[model samples]
Target chain A: MSRQLIIKGSLRRARFTLDLDLDVDLSKPLGILGATGAGKTTLLRVIAGLERDFSGRVEFCGEVWHDGDHFDRVPTHQRGLGVVFQDGRLLPGRTVESNLAFAQQRARNVNAAVSYEALTEALDLNHLLSEPAEVLSGGERQRVALARALLARPRLLLLDEPLAANDADHRQQLIGYLAEWLPAEGIPLVYVSHAAHELAQLTRQLIVLERGSVTAQGETHVLLEAQSEAIDSVARPVAAVVMSTDVEHSTATLQLDDDVAEAVLPGERVLLQRELTEDSGLGPALQPQSDENEG
Target chain B: MSGDLQAVWLTALLAATTTLLLVPLASPLAWWLARSTSPSRSVIEAVVAMPLVLPPTVLGFYLLVMLNPESAVGSLWIELTGDSLTFSFSGLVIASIIYSLPFMVQPLQAAFRAVPESVLEAAATLGAPPRDRWLNVVLPMAKRGYLTGCVLTFAHTVGEFGVVLMMGGNIPGETRVLSIAIYEHVETLNYDAAHVLALGLLGFSFLSLWLVYRYAGHRFEVVRG
Candidate 1:
């Protein structure tokens, strides 16, 4: 059966509104690229059936997940989804092992490509199994969250910045792993990230969202090349790390390679450059380089 | 002495029964109160908390009136079980459940609220149905809340006086619980007997509160997305 995802919906908040009408083929992995507050996460949430207030229809693979009417909808759990949220919301007060087990026990009985031992080893979660989820570092928590989501054996996978917390090395390693693993498993994926190269590496098709609207949609490499060219023409780009983000204010604290830190506001052009280092087989390393301009 | 012992046993049984029943009964209600965004949520909350502030006699009086053998529910009970609901053991159980509702509900509500919507959403995406999420994700994380609620509800039920007196009327084994027994001891000027039961209750209440504070003091904190 050909995998198809159709979403036609609009969600209204006090300060922002998300309006979308998309019909995407799931033959290849898909990516959603956007800045903070560009409705990327909300779009993922709507697909997962978590956005109850969303008024529209969501159909996946000939199955109606949600209809325009609030009452006529499949709840989140029934959607056969595996979502790795940005924050890695591990079940609190439990060991990492228990968290993974919770997903394994509830997983759909499909012939999953990834085994428990292989997943744990690949994710480097064996040592952290006994550790409480609350005590894990940001990167560690995200890894556990990823492993847990996979254990559920979902038909569709939705990842929102899944590698955003990891260090440069692990981030590259995970991206490579996912790029290989997802296709082998035949699980259709909708990956969301602000980092352009990450999307360029893992996805074939891309959708760029800007202020709750689809500004561009096409092949991932084509769009990224165009965006990179657009950046190359006008601004001096410097490599920086997004140390912390303030979504309410639409700002981020970027730690530059020169050891200088700067706060960036909305409308500032921050380009993520893919640095091909000596260990090139791992994948392109993302270094967020910014061009500051007054909005 | 046997009468006093019977009263103590009855009180324990009543408190146990009320706590057991409230676990299932108050769970959905508390979950709704914790999560519902409807305009009527505040109204439902206030009603659930009415027993907390209202005088026990008032609640007992209404229960007595509503559940009397002549009334609809009471008559239905009479037909079903061939027994009167008012001034009976079952009547006392119903009153205790209402009288101690806030004790059970408030803690459970706090616990359910502590289980973040994000975590529940994550669980749902993992193929857990609603009931599974509630059992595995919600109940385990809300352990302290259940502990606090169960202890408080049991303790509060044991401390009942006005409601039991008004509804059950000191029917020894059927309803004359600890507080009522103490009241009778004081009424009969049996100072020695009253002193024993009152001191026991005072110690019991102190321990329950102490357990709640010592164990459940720190709230369950989840990493938010």
Candidate 2:
């Protein structure tokens, strides 16, 4: 897959200094995982052209948005990228329909085509179109925000803990929609979150950040396998996908590390320890063919 | 007694004119003061709010000296418009705008401040330019502030006496407004007409403020929520 976004910059601030040299593929969803204050949000801001106090270069699809030598920086609006902030950030004065309309207008201004009607319908927002954004519930607001951003027809989508406000049911439904929608639409997604389960559900590739630095970058499973020695005793759990659920036996089968095992299913994605346990029946004893235990 | 109509009309005219000019002038300044982190922002803010504390006559005196025919600004005004700046309706309008500047700027600044930075960032990321965001997001959210500012500035300008009297004096049909007219009536011992004009102004002010507080107060409640 071709690289869609390349950002190399050094941002100096009083709180922290972030030195980033990141190249992201356009084909797969990239997950940004970091602890609180690890510069995850700052990284998104820099890439989206929101933070311009940095000296470096940002190239998107062969066009350079910023160059340190020339002091050239494109503003966020012209970057053709959609962002969903943690607060939802819906315009309080506008109705839900009007908010979507404004994004549609922007898409048209940029010569990008977006179907607001289809998007609103898909997001189940047709019934709430006339309601003012201030009255929207947290889940409803996030859905509207997501739909509004998608209606802008951005080439890349940047999400900064966008669903943190949503309840579990809503978050799951929205995540399921995104998992299906993003891949089908072929939009490059850069999802940032402190929640392991969120990143696990959404992305195959992971960029693990710590103290304003990238500590690991590779496939999600591989990075988790290497994560323990990479950082001492920070057992960031790896995600296990549920393959099948046997309701009769009250045990679900999980697929992790090329090994199938029995486990209880509380959700589509569940966190699993690298050292397997007997309750899940996913110990190394059950996986003799796997080389993950070698090194 | 016939002059009461002219005073009423002139007061309305002055207030309307000043409000119209001040709205456009104060909007950008208030927005900048709310959002700017430049070191000079505090300086500009202090300057804008100086009129709120300074005696109106002091402000009027400085304006009088500045607008006199011999000063740089006064000479420029003469060369451009071929008229004296002081003792004219134009001079009164200028003094009123300066005197009422804080009434307009403070409210607008507060309203603009209430708009969260995240909303503007979302607007930018959604492809709205600065102007578009202000028009679509900032303007709508701050509507109550605009209304409050305009009403306060108009009411304040209508009730002003010292600045108008010192800078423009009483030139009937030209510089004489309701406040100056009422003062003149009191000075000449025409208590009946004085009481009439004073009561009329009192009633008008009470109504405008009541209406504004009633409507704009609710908007603030909504904003806070």
Candidate 3:
């Protein structure tokens, strides 16, 4: 498909100016990585047509969304863009079945997209059909949210921190879903996130945003290794986790090599198991926390 | 005296009709005022909500002008339906809708606006369009706001008199609503009949508000505001 989104210009809004300009050809799911307040959400809003306070051009599939001269501010609903919020905005008034039904109500060509039954099966949303959206867990909501979006059959799909509100297991589930589904559909996705590590399972093409502009944008592996070096750890490989907790013991366990690596516990000397060399002292001075889930 | 059961039925019918007319239009306009970013958004918002700030007479006067048979608006209406809209049931309905606009909009707007943009963007990325977003995403997420707006509009319209009085004269079985009946009785020193109508309006409004709060509190904290 010839689907791609291009946004360029200085988005000046009061003190918050999203000056970063970008043109991304979405053959694969591209991660828009940034720290908090880095305009990741703003960028997604522009593409989704929810935000318009900027002097620039946003073209999708060679169709102009907003070009200063040819200003076509297509309303969000007509833009054919799908979004998944941190909390799944499933209609609580409707059951999970009705939620999908509501989305299917808006599909321009409903026959072109996957049926709700097929999507429910794809995302494993069968049991939650009768349940009210409010009662669903974070992971369940995320799954249903994905199902809702897929049913809409959008031109561009946008995800803003899909795993931020989710627990580790839920995050893992969504990542697994993304890996299996996004490529199959071949629809372009601009995944916005604060942490790059959460995108580990997905494609690693990165657009590292800082302040309001892109500080770095390239292949995931290159950006990760280069960034880890540029950061506190000088020129070292690193693995990062989105979760942080105070372990009771003086040691931290890292999951690797089909087992847990405790401060004292041992694992295979697989070099790939190591991330960046850093003050985190991953190789030593770390004790394994109990309840370290191993796959 | 509404010692006659027919009057009671008439009043209930009028109140319900008024509520039905106000909810849908008010909800979407309210959401737009509270969330949209068009350059002229505030102008449209201010105009939609002007009834809240303007005197009831001003609104009533303008509406009366539009429906008067000798005027251009009345001429257009005469052309379309061979009748004037003023001092009629539809006119009263129109006046009541305007009077109750803010009541419906404020609650729904507050509710829609309260939804975190982050949550919405997530849904958009997932592939929801405007209709799907509102139905599957906005409305369900803002259930408290929607319910609050509906009940408030219904109750407010039920107890309406001012704008209705200005635009719709006391024409029994046509434009004569319960509030008008209560006012008519009070003006003519018919305290006994007035007492019955006033109490009915009062008790029912209280009960409506109470029921809404009771049900909504089970799902949301209406007071945390």
Rank the models by TM-score, top first: 1, 2, 3
lDDT of 1 by residue, A116-156 (tens): 99999999999999888988999899999999888889889
> What TM-score fits each model?
0.87, 0.84, 0.67
Order the candidate numbers by DockQ, best to worst. Answer: 1, 2, 3
* Model 3 residue B18 CA deviation in Å: 3.8
TM-score of chain A by itself in each prediction: 0.82, 0.74, 0.76
Candidate 3's residue-wise lDDT over B62-155, tens digit each? 8888777888877887789875678777777777787778777777888888777755654554445567667756776678777777787778
| Share of reference contacts kept by candidate 2 | 0.57
- Residue-level lDDT of model 1, residues B135-217, one tens digit each, is 87888888899999999999999999999999999887898999999999999999999999999999999999999998898
Over B53-81, each residue of candidate 2 has an lDDT whose tens digit, in order, gives 99989999999999988999888998999
* DockQ for candidate 2, C-alpha atoms: 0.32
Which 10-residue span in candidate 2 chain A carries the lowest summed lDDT? A286-295
Each prediction's RMSD over C-alphas, in Å, is 6.4, 7.5, 7.4
lDDT for B167 in candidate 1 is 94
lDDT of 2 at A232: 30
Clashing pairs in 1: none
